[model samples]
Target: MTPAQHNTPAFHDLFATHPRLTGLALAPDGTRLIASGQTSDADGTGYVPGLWEVDRAGDDGIRPVTGSGPGDFAPAFAADGTLMFLSGRDPGERGGTGDVALWALPERGAARRIAHHPSGIATFAVAAGADTVAYTAALLPGATDAESHGRLRRARKDAKVDAVLYEAGPVRAGGDGEPHTFVRHADGAPMDIGGQGLAGNGDTALSPDGSLAAYTRAPTDQAPDTNCVVVADAVTGAERHVFSRAGNQYYHPVFTADGSALVCQRQREETHDTEWRVTLVAFDLASGAETDLLPGFDNWPWPGRPLPSPLPGDGTLWFTGDEQGHCPVFRRDADGTITRLTALGAYGSLCVTPDATTLYALRGAVDGPPRVVRLDVAAPDQEPVFLTAAGGLEPLPGTLTEVRTEAEDGCPLRAWLALPEGASAERPAPLVVVPHGGPQGSWSDWPWLWNPWPFTARGYAVLLPDPALSSGYGQRMQRRGLGGFGEVPYRDVMALTDAALGRADLDAARTAMAGWSFGGYLAARTATLTDRFRAIVSHGGMWNLEAFQMDTDMSAYFRKLFGDPRTQRERYEADSPHLDAAKVTTPVLIVHGGEDHRVPTGQALGFHNDLRRLGVPVRFLYFPDEGHDIGVPNHIRVLYETMLNFLDHHVLGQEWRRPPLL
Candidate 1:
């Protein structure tokens, strides 16, 4: 089909109805490839999740690997074409309990479960040789006092049983916590090397020989200022501080072929914005001295561009960087000289062939789904081989325009405006002000994977403003809303809305606010703070700080954001949206996952109950089987449809005037 025909409404309908492709793996021999993705088939009135596999060769072999429904992922190829992956029997199961099992794919069409768990498996990984399978399974409540612990297990290719290697416990002074570990086994059973700790998020890298491990560790209490690389001997589990930094976060560590040094991406803080630079630093294992191979490498200055993966070689690294608005691959030689490789679109997760002659990359835009591409870096001018089209997904044509507006205090705030095609300046459109989740995170140009398009298609304008606490800027800007959660960030959002309303095409009276998590908290708080918005929608948001502190899973994390609620009771009370529920005049809709352990279901229900008691117009929509965010396609459809109807009723004053619960 022609490119234009492939993007038609009929094509979009087919594409949206299909499953999404996620994890990809290349075999050890580099001659074979295994891909794992989900599919949904209609069963009576609903759809069920299924697993599928595809062979890169063999007459375009693509077929279902599992017979029944459940979600399957994390597919890896074992030695001699044996495939191993995780699967579950029920898609709706949660809280560590469900029939999740480890299955083996002997070939393209045959599969069988080898290990079964009454609870469920969260994640799994297979060694390169495939003889050893390592996985992390959640121990159910009866099995442990802690809510959840990632227990590591390994199995042999010939053995009929599996053995527990390590179980993650609470963080000890020098011991590993949960298995944030990445296993790279060259021979024998997989080694137990890493675990979750301060390591910024869960980025871990193994040495070339699988004898050493390098990872980043951040401070637990606060948003980490700087993270250091801790190198440990894989055999003895002996650890040593290899590299350290003061205020920057070093992420995605990669070991050199010789295992003498490591390369990582460094994010440095600046005023009003954070600049990302990729530096190749070589750390001497013996001397513990870090030498900068190449410093100050900007991965394309434009927002949302990720640094290219380091090429697999010693003294030479192949990585992607954005330069002059286009993403291109660059080769940084041992001598610090760099050369451009390919002028492809934004790409990530570079998988080099075992021979190191070719590289496989995924390229796409935010609105555009990812497509796999195979590039022969040796032939720099040759066109890349396209393995698949984002499997029928079309790119939603839109542009994120950045605008700087002054806050009430005259501080410059950054905002992104996504304008729909054929929109005019004269036609005033309803505005949907979307605040980001992290009071500390910035809104970039990443494609909106959710329902922003549906809103824009219906002639609404979406506004995203980066308040004082946003991180892309610098430390000072991020700290601006540290304790001013209810004050400065709220004001910044309002000022930006007022500025947008000043535009001829923005309908000031038809504005609404929506957010998820912290953004949800802001939206709820804003409704009470002002009567400007006609409606508001909050997803996984906090209602009362006091209740949230007691009910939410991350009480310790919240303590840092608002201080200890016991000692800072007045401060928490002052910053809570629940305190002013009676003042919320605008109609509000609360959406949440029933099993959301992160924010907890109590927060959403508490707000709904309070609003009802106050005689305010509000409605609650809960997905019983979902988590912090809605993942199932059918549920997402329901969420978008409900939101659209809610917006239509309030912003357009059409058909329905108010929800039944409201």
Candidate 2:
């Protein structure tokens, strides 16, 4: 290819058009590797997904296995090596069902819908030996059969009713009617493994024999906000609570090879004095006893997915954990020894060969997009073999470096600094300080949204800092921010930002700050505390602590950390960003989604009004159809384009270039 043709597309354009890989599923026989691939539609307004066969040997490349049109995702494999996935594609000319159903693709024939539900299948998994499918659906209350549930749904739709009546339960975000679990044989009717509901973020696994299914069940008793692990007889539809605790959250249940026990993660509830402490645990199914698998490990196993050892009846598990700056795979032996597996980049979507010899995962780095990689699990110290080329990521326009600093409280703070190419003492790049969201999440892996490449490609040095509350830094680092939002997290972010700007390759005078979600709160908080930044961008941020505690989706969880807003009046007022709006002198850009349940859009509206009333330069970009995240392809382009324009006008003293499409 020519030089210009070989160049990577600009960040905004690439995000809109790039063919992306998501979710990996390995066949039981380890003969096929399937993954969901999404490409931009004709209008460039959304992504259309289809399953692709990924060559495991790295000799042949990836090829599409499904036809185009509507999106298909969440790929899985039945015991017989049939590829199954969830899709919204309708089988008949009845138009569309408006809900996803389970579809199976055979080796010699076309794909066909196998199982479906009235409320649609939320997710599904198949047994490793019998092809027994376990799926979750949202069923109406008191509806005994699918016919009655379908009638109730139709009636509600005809009446234009959109109200959910929760007699006694804590409301959850993005929840529909009520989640119910069901299991089915390869060619038999689905049997109800009835429960109150599946935990919103819980996962399910089926035994190799397909006799039992394990999943996290939502609290149905007096304990309003608790979750428990339950194992159900797939054939008889009977369930028993294998593990439950009053003050702990249990999730991601995986059955052992022999089905004698389950490996899961337990997280103690967060409180005012402590952050979340998570531990990998094993529960004896027959005895109902729990054991701490990682007793003394300091780092948290984020997304701590437990996988059964490939060997028959091995009783060992493999999981992933975040430590320092990289996420690595770790194996727990039957003798309680923990061995670190792969060590280079952040890894996810882990799958192992049938022989327990090879491991495959999507490895990602700050400077590159995620791609399939293979590792020799038998040899733990070897580097990974790249199976799939990094799609759409040509050479980055900059180099990614690390920034280390010490917080005032003696805590170590770190950040990823991306300096534009050719940046030097004579032509230092303008700086952009971007803190990650979740406050609880780290910037150890490559990020699709809130990425820094767009800024780095524009001759700006971006600083992605893992502040006090950021994960991968051990429990003590998270505990340092327990005092309040404006305390250690803010101090750590500013410390790292200052350290990055102190370097001769960065221009401190032309610096801006931006973040989304909790990071957005920190960015707005920084605006109130300092005028060092020329511009600030806050997206989906909380402005008033009192209002946030009252209106957020997880209000109970919020109250647990900050106490009741009504009783603890001082704490609410002390850290609220809106209370200090008059102190902001920098130009501010506010972005929010109307349907954001986590941090309500009112936070943005109120903060914008307060800043505007204080005579501060502010602009608001609102997406009424969007939720906590702006998922639309065109909207993503506009989001980044507007952000770059705002930074250019404010920080670089250039004319604002409004996106013509917007």
Candidate 3:
């Protein structure tokens, strides 16, 4: 299809309408596969869980394993034909307050609810022997007298009783609860006991005999130090610190079949940011010595992108990395020999069958929805078998052009610029500076299945940059602007705007900044720092770090990152843009989800109040039913449409059209 056809209202409407596909898995024997995703209807109504199964034997015959409903996900299999997963509903088929329950289905038909809870199940995995299942569950927040923060529980395959094997959190020792907690199981319950540090930011692996478990533990909170890996006795829960480096975050721990060695992905911290040097390191469990597996290979750094799943017999390790321009699958054998597995464009969320012969991947391009595919590792170049075709959304065609410019400090910055179909580079077009959330996270060229397109389709030039704090580059580059949120990143953005102004196709004077979470904070600060932009939008952002630290869900995490406000009160006061509210002259829009625990609504309301007090042009929109990310379609449409009107009034100098107040 032509580029214009791809950007049609029907195409954009399809994406706006469809529920996103997420989380894919393969059955133990490698014969069957399961996928957990979401589906939404045309009016943005039908939001439901999706469970699908596929036969790897021929063309990856894919079919829906469960009928469409409100909640279903975290799919795993007990054996070849017995599928087990989590559904976000009770046995009565009623939607509940907490997570969904455990459900089972035979390979041939409909699913039946096996377990339900008032709190909810976070995740689950069946043991290698297929006799038991181990899962993680957390008590719902705001529940009175909740005993557990999060715990590891286990149940037999044929038994109805579930028992808690280990529990952690609800830590009241340091005058507050722990930063974060999660249970990682190497195999299944009883024998599968493993624990990581606060962040729930680690990986776990079990030995072939299931006798040992290896895991990585990194400080999940804002603490700049404390990253390590521990090997533990599977039955006893005794942990031995096998590997650790100060300031380096080790993740994705995997064990060799024999359990003699453990392999993990390591990224060192230069300052506050994690550099993207994800190399495989082999830790000899006996000697505790580590060896680099692929020392020079660069892996793409993106959240929710699954790392390479190690195979049992073949000394090869498989992973996804940016090859040329797209993220393709590659395999590196024991001798350090690397081979490309799939020739298809950017792919992610890879899962290998228990037998390790077949690989399942989500494959797609910059303009379309991703489809699940099965690839034969033995035959690298053969056409992949399409397991399921993604419905609803059509691809939006446009060329992804790379733009690089130097920050004010002379540091090089990178961005992706996507222009409208027939838009000429010679004419000036409105621009949007879309900063990604994790200030630490970098924007990749892969299509954002949920964002930026809605604005781009309206003929706006979208500029996404990997600023100083963004990961992927080395540690030094990642930490260049440490503790300089208002200083360095702002300079980089200004420099980017300067470069954009030089481009005849970009209307630099008519630009706006938009972002979520940390990105939102930066956008709000940008409006106060300078009046260069016509408008700004903040989603789930904090105006004051000190206030946010005290009010946020993970206060300890915030303290670690920004430090105790009592001791560093000056830093908090100086860094906060809310302190400089009088300087904000540009029109601003703030959108927040009332249910967001990360950044509470108080932050948005406080800023909105301050903006009004300062006589600044500002608007506040709240989504009461949603959390950090607003998932409801009507809310999303309202948000985008309101944002567009705000941009139109300022950037296009159109008359102000007020949207319905939330």
Per-candidate TM equals 0.70, 0.95, 0.79
Candidate with best lDDT: 2
In candidate 1, where is summed lDDT lowest over 10 consecutive residues? 1-10
Q: Residue by residue across 435-500, what tens digits does model 1's lDDT show?
A: 887564555423323435556655667888777666545344555665657778898888888887
Give one digit per residue, the lDDT tens place, for model 3 in 1-662. Answer: 11132344533455556656676777666766666777764467446777766665546456676543456677766644577778776565545434467777776676676654434554554444424444433333322212333221221223643433233331221211222222233233233244343344425554544455566554544443556777766556577556876656677666665557777776653332333345567788778888887776554433333334444445667776654334567777778877777664667778776667778887765455677787876566467777776565434444567677887667777766766555555555688887767666666434432266676666677777667676655455556767666667777776766776677767666788988887898898898788888889898888977788778866655665666778877667767888888899988999998888888889999899999998888888778878888776666667777787788787888797876643
Clash-forming residue pairs, model 3: 19-40, 88-100, 199-220, 222-560, 222-561
lDDT of 2 by residue, 465-552 (tens): 9988788888898788885887778888889988898898788899999999998999999998999999999999889888888788
Candidate 1 stretches greater than 4 Å from native: 1-18, 27-35, 43-72, 76-85, 88-206, 212-254, 261-284, 287-347, 353-359, 373-387, 390-414, 420-422, 440-449, 471-477, 566-574, 657-662
Ranking the candidates on TM-score from highest down gives 2, 3, 1
Best by TM-score: 2
Question: Which whole-number lDDT from 0 to 100 does residue 404 have in model 1?
Answer: 64
What is the TM-score of candidate 1? Answer: 0.70
Model 2 has an lDDT value of 0.80
